[model samples]
Target: MVAQLRIYTINRGMMASWLQLFYEHIRPLHERLGMPVQNAWVNAERTEFIWVRSFNDREEIEAKEAAYFASPERTALGDQPTRHIAKIEVRVMEEVPATAGVS
Candidate 1:
């Protein structure tokens, strides 16, 4: 599976609206898409929202996400104020092995 990190940078006073979109659109969409969302966070500074979602493969991930976001519902939501999102960063992360084995 591949993981995606989406960082949304909000406009100066758009936190409330952005969060509304998160609940009204994003979270529901994730559930509908059957994508496993590992975590969701709102920055302490309150200017960003971060989400970690995983998909079985890269191609499926891209296609599904593209279609989802391209839909009219999302397009209208995207029109809301945001600093254009900091960036949508995706990566393949590896878990570090633990050294403590035997008790």
Candidate 2:
């Protein structure tokens, strides 16, 4: 299995509003992505927020993410905040030991 992490450094001024909008609109798509979300984070000083997106395998992650991103609904949600996202990063890692609980 492969585990992925998505870190989003968001603009401080818009955190609360963006978080609410994200939960309201993006949460469902993230869930429907059929991927595990390890957790979402907010910095101690409320400077940035990080989101962890986990996947079971590379094939599943690569194949599914495009469709998720291509959807019209997803596009709209992504367009919500223009200046909110300061920086976005993704990390993909293969587990040292295999865990095949993917169904």
Best by TM-score: 2
List model 1 lDDT by residue over 1-103, tens digit each. Answer: 6677877666656777777877778777777776767888888496777888877776777788787777776677765433445444555543334664655
Query: What is the model-wide C-alpha lDDT for candidate 1?
Result: 0.69
lDDT of each: 0.69, 0.75
In model 2, how many backbone clashes occur?
0
Candidate 2 pairs with clashing backbones:
none
- Candidate 2, 1-103: lDDT as tens digits: 6777666778768889878977776767778878666678888484677777767778898777887788788787666755678787788888774556755
- Compared with the true structure, model 2 gives a TM-score of 0.77
Candidate 1 error regions (>4 Å): 70-72, 75-78, 81-103
* Model 1: lowest-lDDT 10 consecutive positions: 80-89
TM-score of 1: 0.68
Error of 1 at 12 (Å): 2.0
